[model samples]
Target: MADEVQHLTRAFSGLGGLGVDEPAMVSALARWRGQPEKRSGFRKGFPGFFSSHGEMERCEEEYMLRLAAEFARLKNLVVLWAMHPWERDARLAHHVLHQHHPAAIVVEVACTRSADELLGARRAYQALYHHSLEEDVAYRARDKPYCNLLVGLVSAYRYEGPRVNEEAARAEAEALGAAVKSAAGGKLLAENGDVVRILSTRSKPHLVETLRRYKEIHGRRLEEDLSGRGREETTTLLLEAVLCLTAPAKYFSQVMEVALREGADEHEKDALTRVAVTRSEHDMDEIRAAYEEQFGAKLEDAIAARAHGHYRDALLSLVMGAHHHHQ
Candidate 1:
C-alpha cells in the first residue's frame, strides 16, 4: 500500500485554516506549573518512563502540548504549532494528559491534524520508550473524537475522489493533486473541511468538473480511492459519503449500518452522534430523504427503537434539525 501510494498528499488540513486565532486563551489554559512539585500538570499521561515533565523531556520525548488557551489566546493555529513542531513530537501529547488529565492537548491536536506528524512524533516518543505509539494513542483516547482523529489519520493515505467540475475545478483539482503528490504517503486528510474550503472558495462547479477531468487523466477515482479500499460495510459507507459529493447520503448509510452491526457500540455511537450533529449544518435533508428510500424508513424511525444514550440523542436531533447548507 505504501509503495502503490507514491506521492500521496493530505486532502484536508485542519492546521492550515484559522477561523479564529487566540493565543492569550491558549496561554491561560496552560497549567504548566500548576501541579505538585514532581508532578507537573502534564505528568501522569506518560508511561514506560517517568511521567514527569523533566523525565519526558530529559528522555527527549518529541511531542506538543496544546492548551485550550491556544484557541482562546489567538485566532491562528500556527502559534499553537510553535508548541507543536513541524516534526513529530509526542512528549507534547503525553505530558498534558497528566496521569488522569482527560488528555494532554498535544494528543487532541494530533487527533484533528496531520497523522504523519502525529505518527512521526509517536514513533519518536516510542523509540525513546520501546513500544508502539499506536497502542498508547488507542488506550488514551477512550471513546471520542480524539480517538477518531488519531485512528482515521493513521489510516489516511492517497485517496482519489470521483470526478468533479466547477469554474475553478481545474485550478482546484491541480492544487489538491499537487498537495497530495508532494506529501509522504503516510499522511491522511481526515478533515475534508480544509480541502473543501480551498477548492470551493473558487467556483465549486468548476472544481467538480476538474475532478472528473483529473480522474480521466490519472485514473484516480477519489470516491473509490478514499473509501473503496476497505471491505467493511462502514468503509463502503464512507466511500459512498465521499462519492455523494453532493447529497452526503453516505452519512445516512453509516448511521443506519451502525445500528445493523454490533448493535451500535460506543465507538460507532459517537460517529452516529457526529453525523446527526454535523449533517444538518451541511444540508442533510437529502440524506434524510435518501434514508427513507434506501433504508426503508425515516432516519428517526430507524434509530428510535434501537439506539440509546447521549449518542442516540445527538443523532436524532441532527436528523430533525433544519438543513443549513454549510456547518
Candidate 2:
C-alpha cells in the first residue's frame, strides 16, 4: 500500500512539465479502480507527498491549459475518480448546482445513494463548503416545486429497512394517483406535499411497492402519467426523481445511451463520464445489462464508438474493470 501510494504520488506529480504523460496517469488510476480502500489511502497520503493545496484541481487546471479540449474530460474523470466517494459526490453536487437545469444531477445524487452514503455526502458537503447540502440546494433552487422537491430530497434520511406496510403503500399510491389526476392541466405533482413526502421518506423497497401498486391501481406507469402533462421543468424533475430512486440501473443506462448517441453535445456527453466513473465499482454490471437490454448493443462498444484517444481509454478502463497493473 505504501509503495502504491508513492507510485500514485509520483504519477500525479509527473503530470506537469512540457507535456502531460496521459497514459501514466491513466495507468495509475486504473490500478485503484475497484479498490476503494486503496483509493482512500491514496487520498489521505496525497497531501503528505505534495506540498500544494488541491493537487487534483491544479492538475486539472494545468491540463486544461496544456491539452486539447477532449483531454480535459479525461482529467476531469481522473479528478473525480481519485477523490473519496463522499467528497466526490459532494463536489459533484456543488459543481452542478451552478449549472443550468441542474435538477437531474441533484436528483441523481440525492436519490441514488444509500442512506449512509447520502449522509456521508451531506456531512462532506458541510465539511468542505461550510454549509449544509440542503441549505445550498434550497438557496440555489429558489423556484417553486424545484426548491421544494430538491430540498426535501437532500434533507431526507430514508428508512432503509425491509419493512413495508401494504396499507400505507396502497394509500400513498392512491394519493399519488389522485395528485396526478388533480394536477392535470394545472400545477404538476411536484407541488403536491404528499408526492414529495412519499418520495423523500419511503424506503427503497417501500417505494418500489408503492410504485408497483401505483401501476396496478392506475393501469400505467406513474412516469407515463407525468409525461402526459408535457415536459415542463418541474414535471421533468419529478419524473427524474422517480426513475432515479426506483430504477437507478435503468436510469443510468438511459443516461449513458443519450450521452453516447451521435451528435451529443458536451453537456450530454458529460453524463457518460460521470455515470461511468461513479457506478463502475458499484453496479456497472447491472447498468451494462440494462444498457444491452434497452439498446440492443453493449455499453462498452457504444463508449468506444463515441469517445476517443486517452479519454476513451480512461472511460473504457472504468467501464471495463481497470487492470490491476501499475506502470
Candidate 3:
C-alpha cells in the first residue's frame, strides 16, 4: 500500500510539466488539490497504508477514481482558459448569429440579459478583442438586408424596469401589425425601421404587452403574422429574434432539441456546447425543464447520445453536475 501511494503521488507530481498557460494550469492544479485532498481526508477511516492486500487494492481503486476526476477538471479548465470568457462568448455569438447568416442568436443573447450584463459582455469583448461587440456587428452588418436592424438590436440598452405603458403598448402593437402586413411579398423598405425600433427599444414587460395586444388586434400572434408571409430571409430571421426575445427558455429548448437530435452535425453539437457553457451558471434548470417538456427526454440523455470522449464528459460535468464554479 505504501508503494502504491508513493507511485500515485509521483504520477500526480509529474503532471505539473504539462506547461500550459499559467492561469489555466494554476486553476487545474488548484482543483486537483481540492479533489485529491478528499483522499487524504478519508485516510483516517482506513488503517495506515500497507495494512493488508485487500486494503491496498481498495486504496488503489479510490485513488484512481479521484485521479480521473482531477484529470477531468484539468481538461475542462484548459478549455475555459483558452480565451477570455467574453471573447469566447463573442466568438460563439458570432458563429451562431453572423457566420450562420442570421441574427436571432445575437438578438436572443442581447435581449435576454439585463442591460448591465449585456454592457459588461461588450466591455469584455472590447477589452479582450480590442473592439466593441457593436463594432463587429456594425462592420459585418453593413449592406446586409437587416443590417441596420441587427446593428440596432445589438446596440440597444433597453430599460430593465418592470414598468409597462398601456398606451404605448397598444400603439406599438398596431405599428408592429401594420409593419408585418406591409412586409408581405418579401418587399422590404426602410419602413421596416418601425419593426426594428419597437423590438430594440421596448422593455421586456412592455414588449410582452405589445405582443399580446398585437394578437388581440391582428387576430394572430405576431410571429404567426410574420411567418408564411412570403417574406425574405431577413424578415424571417427577425421573426425568430422576436420569438426568442419573447420566450428565451422556449427558444433555447428548441436549440437544444436540434443540437441533441440523433446524427446531429458538428455545428449542432457546437451549439449545444455554447448553450451548455453559457447557461450552466444561469437558467439551465429552466432550459432543462423546457427540453424535457419539448423532447420527452432528459437533457443528460440527449447529451450522452451525441457527445463523445472528454468533450462529452466535460459537458456532462457542466450540465449534470450543476456546480458552476468555473473561474
Q: Highest lDDT: which candidate?
A: 2
lDDT of 1 at 68: 26
Winner of 2 and 3 under lDDT? 2
Tens digits of lDDT, candidate 1, 134-220: 566566665543355444433332223444445456565665565445323534343344453542232223444766856865589
- What lDDT tens digits, residue by residue, belong to model 3 across residues 21-65? 233344445555657544553343444321345434244565455
1-327, model 2: which lDDT tens digit per residue? 688677656645433311234665577678778888776566566543323455341224544353454557778889899999999999889888766545688899999999899999999999999999998898887866668878989889998888999999999999999999888757567878899889888888999999999999999999788777778788788889998899999999999998876666666778877998899898888898999999999988887665655667677888878532323
TM-score of 2: 0.78
lDDT-better candidate, 1 vs 2: 2
**TM-score of every candidate relative to the true structure:** 0.34, 0.78, 0.68
Q: After superposition, how far is residue 62 of candidate 1 from its true place, in Å?
A: 35
Candidate 3 accuracy as TM-score: 0.68
RMSD values, in order shown: 19.9, 12.0, 12.2
Q: Which candidate order results from sorting by TM-score in descending order?
A: 2, 3, 1
- Highest TM-score against the true fold, candidate: 2
Kindly give the stretch of ten consecutive residues in candidate 3 with the minimal lDDT sum: 13-22
lDDT of each: 0.43, 0.80, 0.66
Off by over 4 Å in 1: 1-168, 171-206, 215-220, 228-249, 252-256, 280-282, 293-297, 308-318, 321-327
Please state the error at residue 276 of candidate 2 in Å. 0.8
Candidate 1, residue 324: how far the Cα is off, in Å? 18
